[model samples]
Target chain A: MSTNVWNGEHRRIHMQEVGTRDGLQAECAFVDTQDKIALVNALSDSGVAKIEVTAFVSPQAIPALRDAEIVMREIERKPGVVYTALVPNVRGAERAIDARADELNLVMSASESHNLANLRMTQAQSFGALKQVASLARASKLPVDISLSCAFGCPMEGDVSEATVLHWSQRLIEEAGARGITLCDTTGMAYPSQVARLTAMFIEHWPHTELTLHFHNTRGMGLANVLAAIDAGANRFDASLGGIGGCPYAPGASGNVCSEEIVHALECMGYDTGVDLAALIAASKRLPALIGHETPSQIVKAGRRLDLHPLPADFAAIRERALQRDAASAEPRG
Target chain B: MSTNVWNGEHRRIHMQEVGTRDGLQAECAFVDTQDKIALVNALSDSGVAKIEVTAFVSPQAIPALRDAEIVMREIERKPGVVYTALVPNVRGAERAIDARADELNLVMSASESHNLANLRMTQAQSFGALKQVASLARASKLPVDISLSCAFGCPMEGDVSEATVLHWSQRLIEEAGARGITLCDTTGMAYPSQVARLTAMFIEHWPHTELTLHFHNTRGMGLANVLAAIDAGANRFDASLGGIGGCPYAPGASGNVCSEEIVHALECMGYDTGVDLAALIAASKRLPALIGHETPSQIVKAGRRLDLHPLPADFAAIRERALQRDAASAEPRG
Candidate 1:
């Protein structure tokens, strides 16, 4: 196997922040353009390898991300940090190119039902549209990546087969000339064995392509799936700040894997997730006020694992009392 | 090396429900004795291997569990399920023995500071008292298990070494003749690598003893740690319904790993957890009204992964329109 990732050997892990695009797109309330810009800038300062900055889809479809062009253009891009924007069609691709995005993320779903319900198109149509967008981006010399939603299991159609996922991935990579593919667990149905199996298969098939694993914590298996993917040799992951983001279609489902939570776990496991957890957590703490609700970030709520709490106010007295009791119990009479 | 738990090999996993003891112990409001007995009865029908029914500590110390004796007596003990009770000293052990508890779980912290702050005694005092409890339980032919709190890390002291944990476990297992041991991530400070290392060592040292893992979701690493422990050969886990229970001393920390969430994941991963998940979830859904607060259970909120959502209302019409649009586009439109 590919040098078991858990053999006490730490390696560099590339974390991509997707809260701005995937997370914001699902929110009902529109975040101000300036706040979005500020969030992106803060993430740029953190050491995430990439940021899915925004989506260039029709504003009518995702009013929450209507200020995508402005966000893409106004943010002060950091060197070495890839800024990607979601594009649903050639028009969105043109907009992303105009906004100077570093990469174009073409979107579609692996499951036909999800693709139809989500994109208002069939899987064939989605591939045809995304292929054109990929060609357009390629002509503009911008790297294009495909995000296959419901790759693991569809909320409407349970258990999308591994063969189906690979078939779609093959077409996306070979036919569309995509540089990377992210298998999105849209409703967090992925288990560890399934993740390991698919990750290993995908890596074996596309050894050189950038393969990212995107998971949702809807079922509380997000971090476990991440560990499984890492064990199977997939490094890149998409995480959201404050764990804010869920499938708008799946009510009661939790958001994306919490960015700070996953980073803390990876760092503790000896992986070098270049991002500064303190800076990221500081940014995450701002989400409750900014989003007008609480996000599901455990690390944000509990602080880092090592963030020590002060002993009880009467700790000295308690210790003194215990010591006295211990001494008394050890007395000759006793 | 231990057959790789994720090698697609299915096995039976033993799940222990600890909501009544560990979960309710930290709750401020008192769940009535009748309600406690009903909760335990519900879990008994859910196919869990064990239920930590109640704690036999002094009622003055934990008024939330003041009805422990009544709860223990009234819980209609299921034949196959082992009913366990937490005992802090000889008096508690005697009470548990009188209640006809199937197992006596003696608890103490691995860290000196946490032991003093939490149990109001030094580690030596806690151990001495627990040793007596174990011997008393042994004399009564009741199985004894020791839960080493802060086995992963302590909130006040931080990073309780594996060496410290193993040392205490050795003393409890060898000196006290304990039959089982639980390594508790009392503060949710465990990461996967740390769990893997410690579990392997613990299993290696005490191959014949039943090793149970108790984890908190304080940092969102609870389930991930569970996966790691399983990979390292641990089969028993302590989980709570509704994910209730946290370190009262560490405010803001999340509760124990959600029993339904973990069972759902394990069942999905092909492991026969022996849990009737639908029944377990039914019981978990009762937590909000019963406990008078919302729980942190993702499975209870999101439903099981295969609990499919119905297709959108206009899905047929949408698919028709997409198919018509695809035909038009393919016909070489001018």
Candidate 2:
């Protein structure tokens, strides 16, 4: 009944391409450090506000990103594009700072079961580690961004309580002074209502902190969650190219929300994302080769809505070629 | 910054399963008549408000639905479910009535290029035909539902004007007494804002008419458009099972939005869809055998978020084998 119902969020949205890190992290084949640089450079050219180049973790922990420093150093950081890296601990923060990362992305699962399963540490241990990383980030003059994995829900545990999310977020922000926070739907268990509720809570509590939404299309609700966040007034998002990446815990599962799909939806709705979709799409094109596999991107499978297909060469004569040629004859036997 | 942002449309939503007709129409294989009956019967039992059983076009028009009458005659329809049939012309309407189809779904593209290219007729000719069908439907006591294909945009002609959509809808309701209308994103060109604007306008003008949205996931915005429509106060939708039904015009392109995906989203957001998701999912499982191919349904690929996988057989040994092997490895990195 009201026109103002859906346009609550009409401001410019910012996208952070995390394909080079989050997307390729769990892949079996090791992408050449040179290819990773190329991907990051291309994504940087797309006018994204941030590019998460790589994760600085133990080489044995994630063999896919063993050359984290190589990628962070090799990428040509464009002006205005913040080059960030995923740091799991103090050691990661040191490496990211050494590589001159503009921001340090520290992650911890909000769910206790996932925190143990994913990081081999309790939530308290993760908080302790993050506290240390936060101090180092402040000393190095780099912003510390926190991502609460499984904030929506967990695979090991069915539902992560909102109380748990709010409590951890308060610790991560109030105690650690995180410059930004991402409430990640790690395995895509998020629905719109949950996203709206949590986003509203976060925005209300920490009005000054940059709130980014990180969603996986594991259940095909990734873009849907993005829409919900937009309505709830969130601006920053983390997305993967070509929808690559899978949880090492759950192989054959989808990774992050496809960056192309997110930007495409926003741009279509007249929202200025400041990212060049054509350039981002061009970057997504190279993902299959870089990752050595076909992608799950819908834009790749189904061209842009404006991309018109040529009419049939025999459009005038094709009516007789329809599959229902015998339907008349099959009708109730005269 | 307020919680009153997105809770605008909290109401009952209805799902119409169009898989048996729209999904199978463009398939290469002709499903067995018995399978069609079984599929319809299963969907009926799933608590869906409507089931589009088959199209009554000339068997010559779509040979895939050659057994429309037989399938319609044999399937056990549920008491509350409305078994609808697609009718292309007067002859199709006659057969649909004979087969006891409760509703007749008549369609014509809004864009003239799509109308001619898809239906092989001009817009005015389609209007004339629909006029005749509408009068017949009134006489036979069957509701005439008109679908304006490519109402959002057309693959052949690009953006169909909003003025054209409103004009045709006005005539269909005022002149033909059409009971319901469907705004079809035939090629998945619809974005959220466009859907919101059009839905709001339709709701404003035809306050009492049943406005249903038909979207294709061609560009991964099908569910997003559904969200926008919901925000704009539309409660009815048409979705295909297993995400079947590719566009013949754009070969290999996705067809209607997956029914499971739509219902999953609505049910997750606390809207009462009335249909049982587990039952719908179980019915969707039989589609591969019935259609002789794998489907694009995400729930099948990723499973529900609540469907947890068992922890690995080597869970204890695997954690000690994490990629980040050392908490002390980051002690200033030497």
Candidate 3:
């Protein structure tokens, strides 16, 4: 058991900013192409490890992200920051490759019910399509990220077995030759125990696979899950700026965990996320106007813990004030 | 080392509703007496272990809770629920006893700067006053809860040492006979490791005392702090409805953890809080109208995790819709 989660050798925690893709996809209003470029540029400058820039899906299906190609091409990519894109199939992968995306992300659900509801595909069909996309990705010398949606638990199917996730993971690794696998709590049904159990099993089973955990704060346990996963030694995780992403099925739930909150919590607990929270929050200042509403950001409302509030000039003379008030009240004059 | 925080031990968690006192005290507008009565009555019916009905401070100092007596007398006190009140001095204790409060709560700051700013008295003076109040409470046969504010950290004077907290805790126990000691993160500067370390020391040093934790989400770790405290074997906590409270010193900070969110998170993790979340949330629904503002409630926004959304009528036929749409788009438009 990894008893001390933060006290081991220097473990570099990586945060993937997914606001540009996962966050804006759920918005009713379309974020302009120039705004998308600006947002991604700001995130890149915030020293995030990776940024899921956009999704290369059918424009007809998700019109909000129709500018994926332009967003992928127009952004000024930094040297160390890896810009990734979500691709649904070979066609999207083709677009992503053409657009010079650094990484390609593919997703399929572990539960058949969710597979049908979310992607309009069966488990077998999704695997076949992803296999083809994986072949294309391999031929293009691009890395693949397979995000098994509902890896924690499914909304339609209450609990997804670990064996199912492992089986798909094995297929994605061997058959699709994938490099990374993301266990997504698509509907926020994950608890710390469940997260710890799965993370330990994944680490023991697939030692070479780069595992990432995607969480939604639908149940408000997102940061706790992060703590649990880190305790189990899984390094990479997905977070959205301002906590803007949400599971469409779980209406009214928080989108993803707030990037600033997660980074702040980890840094406080002595883990180095290497992301500057002040710069990230300064960038978050533009979100309300762009999104036309307040983002689910707690740090924006409550400044950093060390950011001191202004005290009255007479704070040191408080006893004198009290004594004077008491003396005045004791006098006989009204 | 408690490796498994959630073991087979049948641990019962207790939540104290402080919205009426801690939450409303910060409100710019006064909540009506009838509404206060209705709110406490609703909280009582929801089966919370304790509800801080009001603070018996000077009306001139805090006019928001000036109708403390009326609220206390009017609320339909549920059986098995402890209704507590905050009393700062001998006069406040007398008023609390007159109001028939079950418990009297007194507070002093561990940091002298905070002590001066908040109470207009030195630490020694505050201790003397609280000792007198404690004697009064002992005569009236009422329990006393002494919350050491900034037990974690203070804004003006950063990094409050654990020695300061332990020193005050010992004084409150030996000198004032405090039955309950709350280690308060008065400015939201307490981290999880600090919380765990202090809680363990307190538990080991004072086995007879009931230790409760009070957290502010000023830095977005309020719920995370709850998890840490629970891991350290603490079961009692203070939370407010709708996340209504804020630190007057820490502007734009969240006052208390949202009651429904904490209850919901605990119940999800299989801990029995014994409070009805739906019922508490139902009561929380009226807070917006009473507070004249939107609340920072996640459960209010997201609903319960088990609350399933309405599925599309053509959910099962999603594949067919996609295939048909694909086929139609393949053919050229007329």
Candidate 4:
């Protein structure tokens, strides 16, 4: 049995900011293209290393990203910042390439049932489409990352076997020529042990493929799964600011794990994710109004751990006096 | 250098419900004694192994728990359920004993500044008083547990040393004769590394003492810390239903780890906590109105992982039709 150890500095984990696309897409209200650009720019300024700017699906399917081209065009691109776009197929990849996106992300559900329901395609068809997208991206000298959605477990299929996930992952990396694979707890059915087991198996099989984790706080094991993955030697992660973006098909599927929360968790564990939490929270303040609903992120409401609220100067003195009185009264005399 | 291994059937960590005490104490509105009693009875009926019913402190300090004596008396104590009370001093222990509390929980701050600020006494004085209370509890033949608040780190004094926590913990177990020790992330400053180190140290020194963890989600590390503690050999935990409770003095301190969230995390990992999550969520329905604020717990808002909302019968047909359309569009060569 391996024991958990604290070597302090060796505990750092990476965080991916998904606020711009995942967060805004779930909003009931239409965030104007300007506001979307502002939100993306704010997150970029907050020192996030990478931001999932937008998805390139058909405009009719998701009207929220109809201005994806415009928003991508208007945003100020910072040096050293990686801008990624989520593409559903070759058509989406073409738009992303035209928009000059730094990275392209493609996803397909591991469970065949979910894939048909979510993407209007079978698993084989989705993989075929991904291979074409990967070839196109590679031709243009762009990086392509494949995300295996519902890798842990699926809502419709119940428990997903590890062999299924590994089989798809291997096919994607080998045939599609993808650079990295992200295992998503799309329905938040992952337990820590499942995470450790699946992650270990994946790492053992694809020793060279970079692994990232995408989790939902739907069951409140988002961070637990992250820790388990980290322990299994997977470090990269994808999180939405304020935990935005739930699967429209999966009921009770809340957004991706909160970006600020993940950054705070990583930083506290001595991991250098290069994201400023206070700035991230500041960027998240525009979300409630923009999304037309209250956010689910805890740090936005409670403030950061080190955030000190200003108290009345006399408050401490008054409390001290009360303590003194209590001490005197409670002291036993000989 | 230890890697986490996935051993299926690892016993699920036990959860000690503190909703009645810690959850209720932080609310401004006073729940009537009968209502408090009803809540406790409901929790007891829900099959939790232990429930912290109330805290015996001065009414002037915490008026919310003023009717601790009446509430404890009226509870319909279930068989095998350990009813615990949070006692601040010898007088509090006397009252708890009078009320027939199954267990007396003594609290002391691990940080000197927090100890002085919270208890109105130095560490030595608090330890001395705890010894007296332990002696009385032993004479009365009641079980005793010690909770070291701010054991991980403190808001007033950042980065509480591991040596200090272990030293005070040993003192409490040895000198005060505590049957168990609970380390609290009072300000939620504990990272996974810190939790692993402190819990390992405590377990190493006081091998026989039962170690419980009480973590706040203030920094969003509550559940992460719990996983680390579990890996460090801790089995007992203190969680509030719907993640209730906050520290009045600590500005950003908010909500204890949610019971439903923790239960979901454990059960999904194949550990058996023996608590029904749906029933727990049902029991927490009154929490919003009782606290007069919406809780931050995800399970309370989004429901469980497998919880499926009633779907329209047309949903499946609509998805199937969409898939057929896509497949027809793809058949070009024929």
Candidate 5:
């Protein structure tokens, strides 16, 4: 209800396109490094302020992102685009920094069970790794953003309390000196009320820290959650082009919230997303063949709401003529 | 934020499953009448108060719905489940009445251009036909529910004003004696603000009439609009299982809002939809083969948020054994 919440003056939320890295990571076949670079370059051209290029994890751990260095090097660095990479530890942070990433993203799972299962580390160990990465990025003069995965709910731990998320967020801000913090509904177990409540709590507790929302469409509440976050004064969001990501741990967890769909929804509601819907759809259309399956974006399948394919004026005349001819032919007099 | 609004005490909104009618109509291939009957029977078994069985339009216009009669006859009607059908004209209404349909759904497009293009009739003519159909259904002691298509916006005419929608709604309720009216975003152009504004306007004007909000996911604001409508005191909604159905005239328009998605969103938010999501997903899975295309419903692809597929405890030992076997086989000298 607050018109000022989405005005043009407020620093526009920078949408970070993560389809190339997180999206392609879950594909059945390996997307070549060149294609991944091309996708990132295309996203850069779409006016997205930030693009997560790739993850700097062990090649043996994630074979899909083996060519992260090549992808980072080959991408066309647009004038104002901030290229970021996901880093697991100090070694991964060094790899991202060496690749000249404009920003480094460190993720620590909020759920202890998920942290242990995913990063093979306890909460304390993961926090130590994050601190080390943050220190290294700071030393290298690279901006650091920390994403707290499973902030809303964890697949392993049935329900994750909001207090845990807020506490970790505060720690990430104070201890690691994270420049920005993103709360991830990693398994997409977020309800709209929960999103609104949690986002409001985060904003209230840490009013100065830059906050972002990373929601998965795993349970179809991605856009709904985004709307809730918007209501809670959250603007920055992480989305994948064509909703193209899957959680390796959570089987059947499909894509991240489709970037194009989010942009379309926000722009239509009179919010300034700074992303072109038509160009975003055009970019999404190229992914199905490149990824060997259809992207789950609704905007890609159905064009914009006002998009019309008008029938030519003479089409009815032609049909009428054909009908008249058929009627004449069917007459008995011949 | 009024809990009493959706507390299911004074007023409760009912969902009429239109999968059998609208869902089947959109499919290119003819779903077997028996299969339709089975689906309707299954929906009847669910706690949904109403099930729209089939449309009684001309077989020449839509061959997909030719077996409406058989589908209506075969469905096992439950005690409180009201079986309904779409009646385009007096003839269709008569047919529906003869088929023992509990309610007759009469449709009239609010936009004259769409009405003419889709129904081959002027707006006046369509209303005249609707009046006759409503009268016939009333004479037969059958309930009549009116659906105003393009109530929010039209494909031909970009913006359909609230005045036009309200005028037609008033005409249908007062002149035609329609029991209930559904405002349809046929091309899916309505925003949340628009939905809230229109719903508040309608409820204020037509305090005694039953109001239902039917939306499409063409622009991906379907659920958001539903939430807005609920916030504005609208109770009833029309949704298709697996988000089936599209307007033939509205090019590139996507399917109806998925029933399971809506139900899941509402239920998780503590609103009672009176529909089982797991059962709804089970029903939706049978649709791809029947419709000859994969459905766009998210719940079918990724189950509910609380749905857990926990790994068997012994599976970890099996994975460890496999890892050891691979490591041993990789040894060169041994």
Candidate 6:
């Protein structure tokens, strides 16, 4: 019944762009390595806090990101932006380190079935593997962040328990020495209330650790869930450029939370996102040609809320007729 | 700064469907009269609190709803569901009353330029005409509700002042004998903080009056704005089936807030929307066939979050291989 629930705190929000890794991995046409570097370079100037540049998995495992090492080594890195790479094992970690990534991002699913299905390993095995990757990253003096996929729910397993998610998060930090954890809604199964509960729980348990909330717009609750997480004290998020990435299980479904749309919304709501929105949108505009497909970004489709449309061609005539009608009606009906 | 901002109050939300009127009015292809009746009947069973069945405008103005009278008279009205019709003037009010509509919805824009462009009348002229329509409805004992379009922002005028919106709302209620008001985001310009401020202001000024929030998903902030309005104590919303009706000024943009998606979200968030989500989705699925185009409803495309997908075809083999791999990796340091 409280009406004062609008948190117009104007706090800082950390936006992480994941189009190169999470988004490109699902594309049907492979983007040229130079284009990938260009995309990352464009996003770098947009003031995003972090950028997931590429994944160092096996070329056979994910051929789209086969040029990950080259991409990591060649891009003009911005000073304030943290350039990260998704690493699957110690070998991947060594490659990322050699290529000079700012941070090492490791991945596993909170649900057991998703872990096996996605990574061909049980939860325990995946944890063991990621632990070694984390250890290698730590030994190389690099910060390691673990992304726990399906933290909300799994398409194969339905609902993954919060206890299971928290358990893995605790281990990834306590044992693997991960400095941060990302709760990823891998299949867009998270709703706002669930997002609020989980975000609050995570922030309460680990106040000092870096927390990022990643969502997909698969069910159209992406922005709503973002607001809920922000209300529950989450300041970091993962977004994809042009809203590209998550494969549509059915036609017309959306992908990840769009970077430009999220930045636009946060900026409108008085949040300090540190993002140059016009610059971000310009980069998003090239996604369709680069990816050979249209993206689900609403901002890219319909410009920002303040972007006014020109008056209809007959507007001056229409106004004149309206005034004449009003004057004639005032005089009285014959 | 405040983490306890998620108001998970299990309140009852009144969902009013406007697809048959606001949505269909903008379509290039006209839906058949019988089909409109069928759509209304289907939604009647979905437990929505109200339905804007049709608009009683001149066939010249909106040829799409030309058979409004026949459609209204033919539809099987359900008990406990109010059937309303959009009435632009006294003549429209008379026709709506003759068709046995339960309520009359009068509309004008909060912005001057939008009013002239959309309704071909200045603000004062439009108010005078609607006041007469409201009087006619009052005489017939049918409740009159005013819908103020562009209450958030005007597409041509940029930003509509809140003072103008509140001024019109006050006149429509205090002078025009209207019982309810709907703040319409005609071109999807509303953001959350703006929605929060306006909704709270309206609730504060008119605590006893019925208030409905109408939104478009043009910028993908429709549901986020809905959540913000709810936090500010709004209970009624106007949604369109299949997210249809708004003519896309740009390609790949959405129209109105989708009924099934809103019901699905509120139900997930523990609010009692009293809508059968499956039945609503069933109706939304029929939109493409009836309208000859795909709709923007996410639930219609991807199914509900709880609706799990079948495991991948090679899952059993993949699981066996994964187990063996884990077993092999457990024993080794070559």
lDDT of 3: 0.86
**Candidate 5 to truth, TM:** 0.88
lDDT of 6 at A166: 88
Candidate 2 has an fnat equal to 0.57
The digit string of per-residue lDDT tens for model 6 on A1-334 reads 2333254466899999999899999998899999999999999998999999999999998999999999999999889999999998888889999999999999999988788878878888899898888878878899999999999999888998889888999999889888999999988899988898899899899998999999998888999899888878899999999998974454568879999999998888888899999999999998889889888898989999999888889999999998998688789677
- lDDT by residue (tens digit), candidate 1, A1-334: 1345554256878999999998888887889999999999999998899999999988898999999999999999899999999988888899999999999998889899999998898898889888889889989999998999999999899999999999999999999999999999988888888898999999999999999999999889898899889888899999999898986645666879989998999988888889999999988877777778888888877888899999999999999998998788789993
Which has the better DockQ: candidate 2, or candidate 6?
Answer: 6
Q: Which ranges in model 4 have alpha carbons more than 4 Å from their true place?
A: A1-12, A45-47, A247-254, A277-282, A285-294, A308-334, B1-8, B249-254, B286-294, B309-312, B319-334
Angstrom error at residue B329, model 4: 6.2
DockQ of each: 0.75, 0.36, 0.46, 0.42, 0.30, 0.73
Give the true-structure RMSD of model 5. 6.0
Q: Can you tell me the DockQ of model 4? A: 0.42
The full ranking of all candidates by DockQ, starting with the best, is 1, 6, 3, 4, 2, 5
Instruction: Give me the candidate number with maximum DockQ.
Output: 1
* Fnat across every predicted model, in order: 0.85, 0.57, 0.54, 0.41, 0.35, 0.84
Candidate 6 segments whose C-alpha is farther than 4 A from its true place? A1-7, A248-251, A330-334, B1-9, B247-251, B329-334
| Candidate 1 residue-wise lDDT, B54-83, digit = tens | 999889999999988888998887788999
* Residue-wise C-alpha lDDT for candidate 2, range B161-266, written one tens digit per residue: 8898999999988998889999998888998888989998999999999999999988788888888888777989999998998876555657899999888877
Model 6 residue A293 CA deviation in Å: 1.8
Candidate 4 achieves a global lDDT of: 0.82
Q: In candidate 2 chain B, what residue range of length 10 has the lowest lDDT sum?
A: B1-10
Preferred candidate (DockQ higher): 5 or 6? 6
**Which model is ahead, 1 or 3, in terms of TM-score?**
1
Question: Per-residue lDDT tens digits of candidate 4, residues A74-182?
Answer: 8899997889999998999999999999999999999887787777677877898899999999999999999998897777777789989999998999889988898
Ranking by TM-score: 1, 6, 2, 3, 4, 5
Give me the displacement of residue B158 in model 3, in angstroms.
Answer: 2.1
Q: How accurate is candidate 1 locally (lDDT)?
A: 0.89
Candidate 6: tens digits of C-alpha lDDT, residues B1-334: 2322254466889999999998899888899888889999999999999999999999998999999999999999899999999988888889999999999999999998899888888998999998888888878899989999999999888998889889999999899988999999988999988898899999999998899999998888899999889878899999999988774455568889999888888888888888999999999998898888988888988899999977778889988998888778788768
